[model samples]
Target: MLDGLNLEVPQGQIISLLGPSGCGKSTLLRVVAGLTPAKHGTVSIHGEDVSQARSRLAFVFQEAALLPWRTVWQNVRLPFEIRNQKSRKTIESALKHCLEIVGFQPNDWHKKPSQLSGGMKMRASIARALITDPEILLLDEPFAALDDMLRSRLNDLLLRIVAESQRTMLFVTHNIGEAVYLSQSIAIMSRGRIAELVEVPFTYPRSSELRSAPEFAAFYGRVSEALYRSER
Candidate 1:
């Protein structure tokens, strides 16, 4: 249902898709991820179409979407099992690195999804996405279900991941504060297209204190006004 919508995410930067519910923010992410087909226009990464560049990308959903029956280790390793691309040694090395990156302990690795808390489940999900060592990450409201504190922690985790790995990221969110906090630019969507693109002037490696700053509030207000106009 997108019409004339276009966006370009610069390399190694985060761009957030922000809009009201049902405004096609998630749909746009799906199209970029190749989960949903685009009837017109193209999704490309570094001049290659999405189909060609897919191997370099990874996606994280709102829900952990982990199999209830699988333990955290099993779930995180599922991509390797499906792709069968890496050797056992490489896979194990990757699993260890990804788990460490997401701050998971050895004891929690054997637990099933049912046994973990909400934040822990998200950590597993993020670790699963990282197993592939993707260059681009597509996130669809990944922290929406968590409490404020958990959400903030995960947001910081995401920032750290990007800083360390230099991966380009596209994040979809209904939360304006999140968009301002995480993105270098925010694309505000409405009626199936980008209504406005707002730049976040704040520098990266931003702390939680940035959210309480006067400049942050001013940028937030600007984005809010743009969103209101888009909805009208």
Candidate 2:
């Protein structure tokens, strides 16, 4: 039920969608991911429409969504198996790099999802998303289920990954601070449309200490105000 929504994310930058519940944030992500169809409008990535750009994108859901029976390695390798775009040797090589990027130790690779902690499961999910080497990454509240400390840690991990990979990302979150901390810009949505786009003035490689700074608090307040106005 989106209403004339349009957004343009710069190459290699992260854009977060922040809003109240049922404002179509998750639905927007789904539309861009091509999981949900739009009645009108076109989604373009890297100058190509979504259908043409599908192979260059990857998505990470709120839940890890790893198969219960699969080991960590198996879960991360699932994309390659489904796509059949790479040879076994190539996939094995890529799997090693992806797992290492997400901070999975060699020993933990054989463990099933039930044996892993929530954070570990998310790491596996991110690893799975990275396996495809996508140009754009779409995330739907990927950290909502984790505790504060763990979420902060993974936030740092995600920033590091983005720095190294330079992938464009669209992240959806209800937390103002998290949205401010992670995105280059925040798009505040209301009633199925973008109400405001706020630029984050801080440079990247932002540490957790940034969250404690006065400037960060000011920006967070600004975003919160924007959200409040949107809802009203």
Which regions of candidate 2 are displaced past 4 Å? Answer: none
Give the per-residue lDDT digits (tens) of candidate 1, residues 36-66. Answer: 9999999999999999999899999999999
| Candidate 1 ranges beyond 4 A from true positions | none
lDDT by candidate, in order shown: 0.94, 0.94
Candidate 2: TM-score?
0.98
TM-score of candidate 1 versus the correct structure, residues matched by position: 0.98
Residue lDDT tens for model 2, 61-105: 999999999999999999998998668789999999999999999
- Clash totals, every prediction: 0, 0
State the weakest 10-residue window (summed lDDT) of model 1.
Answer: 84-93
- Give me the displacement of residue 69 in model 1, in angstroms: 1.0
